[model samples]
Target: MAGDTKERILETALALFAQSGYLGTSMHDIAKELGITKGALYKHYASKQEILDSIVERMNKMDYERAEAYEMPETEPDGFAEAYLHTPIAKIRTYSMAQFDHWTKEPFSSNFRKMLTLEQYRDPKLAQLYHDYLATGPTKYMAAIFRKLTDSDDAAMQLALEFYGPMFLLYSVYDGANEKESVAPMLCAHIDRFIAKIESGYRKPHAEGA
Candidate 1:
């Protein structure tokens, strides 16, 4: 089928892109990997850039789906610290673990991540994608959730930084092998510290009426 062939071409292109930086790869490489002629490849994508664009689009859809799946509760309970500590903490852990698994386990998803990370420095489009998806996107999403829960944009931003910053750092430093084993505990530990800090903030008394 036309759609199947197009999907195959994209998958092959992504693998090649991941193995060799985008600039390092060529249409011939993708076609050879797919066992298709260059002419056949053109039937699906007008150019190599078009293939990259399609891959980016597909990965972006996956990213949005994951983000939406981790939606925060609409209303906080009677106690802020207690509610967050008990509910979203667990949910966030689950969400983070799922993210780790997706980034490490899924071939297409993981390769897409690697391709973008490697190419971001060289390609402006990839750089923007890196910032939009991996950097600012998660932080902004968390900020919105924290704002709803804490009622303060500043506090929310702080919490987002505390929560996402270390995790992103870990991701950057992560080597391919044993990433889940190596990073899962650290991620959870960071989450624990982050929640403790949030709870500490709630316990602090306001300095006389300002």
Candidate 2:
């Protein structure tokens, strides 16, 4: 029950944070929404910031779990691109699309992303988190995966942008979507085309030692 309460507190805090900017939402609001007293909430979370930290931790854990489940390569001493080199493009595409679905669909991840987006402008701390989670962090991760395939850092980073930019744009479209179906097909088409492009234009030659 103690563990359950802690989970509940994080979930409730995240939902409230998404709906109301993190700064706008208060401890009282989370406790009230949970139908609990402030004192009870504090028993589980000493502070709202602590609750947010737990939420971020869970989000990171889920990200790696989802990546593993999809068989996406993880960074190694050599590089993730090296790991991805032997992996199937279809599997990579599956992992990429799964991450897309996760951020846009899964309640916890979706709420966390939305909370970061909403609160980013209101707090410098959250703004950095917004960039870390949604922007620079993902770009850097993808760039690392592209590094060995490209001739230079600029080229790798550019490829990362080219690969990820479309899906990045789609998040907002999906969020505003009346039906999720409207956005899913676009994502599907994108993954297919981009995978084909990478195979023909990039990875094949690399495989041949070009």
Candidate 3:
């Protein structure tokens, strides 16, 4: 029974937080929506900050799981690198866009956007989660390919960003955009060009070097 209550509270809180944000939502709002007293709400969550913490924890776990499935070989030669860059680029982007689309259509969508926008101020720790995850995980893997393909560290980093930066940006933008006409194809094309550019840099100089 206690576990069930916690689940209900979390589900309600996630929905409300995604709609109104931490500041906009009150304990009374949660209690009233749940048809319970403020005291009952406190039994589950001490405060709004605690709720934010829980939400961030859940989001992080979801992100980590998604990234785990998409992991790539960090250091590989041209053949594997090219294949790595091509296959998952489109599929992952499209999957991410679909999730965003689903969320935007929900009543909590506006609040969710506001929380994402204002969350930096409210919880600095949560703000850095996405960057930290990308830098250490997915982006790190791609960076290895970039370094192998381009002798210059700056060039490699730039190339990796060219592929990932837009992917991240498009997921945020396309969540609310039209679904029938999506941005995934265009983003894939741009990434493909980036891959081709990386491949060009890896070619050995023939008589020009000799």
Which candidate achieves the best lDDT against the true structure?
A: 2
lDDT of 2 by residue, 1-210 (tens): 899989988888898889987888999999999999999888888998888889989988997888788877676725777877888877887888888988988989999999989988889999999999899888887888888878898988998898888989999999988897789889989889878888898889888983
Better of 1 and 3 by TM-score: 1
Q: Which stretches of candidate 1 lie over 4 Å from their true place?
A: 67-88, 148-154, 176-180, 199-210
User: For model 2, how many clashes?
Assistant: 0
- In angstroms, the error of model 2 at 9 is 1.2
Which regions in candidate 2 have their CA more than 4 angstroms from the true location? none
TM-score of each: 0.77, 0.95, 0.62
* Model 1 lDDT tens row, 1-210: 888888888888889988998899999988888888899888889999898888878887887687568763434323433334445456867877678667766888878878878988999988887788788887886776566446688987888898888877877556544545777777778877876775567423321211
**Residues 138-162 of candidate 3: C-alpha lDDT, one tens digit per residue:** 4665576656456677877777777
For residue 206, what is the lDDT in candidate 2? 80
- Which candidate has the highest TM-score of all? 2
Q: What lDDT score belongs to each candidate, Candidate 1 first?
A: 0.75, 0.87, 0.60
RMSD of 2: 1.4
Q: Which ten residues in a row have the lowest lDDT in candidate 1?
A: 201-210
Error of 2 at 34 (Å): 0.6
Which parts of model 3 are misplaced by more than 4 Å? 1-4, 70-114, 121-123, 129-145, 196-210
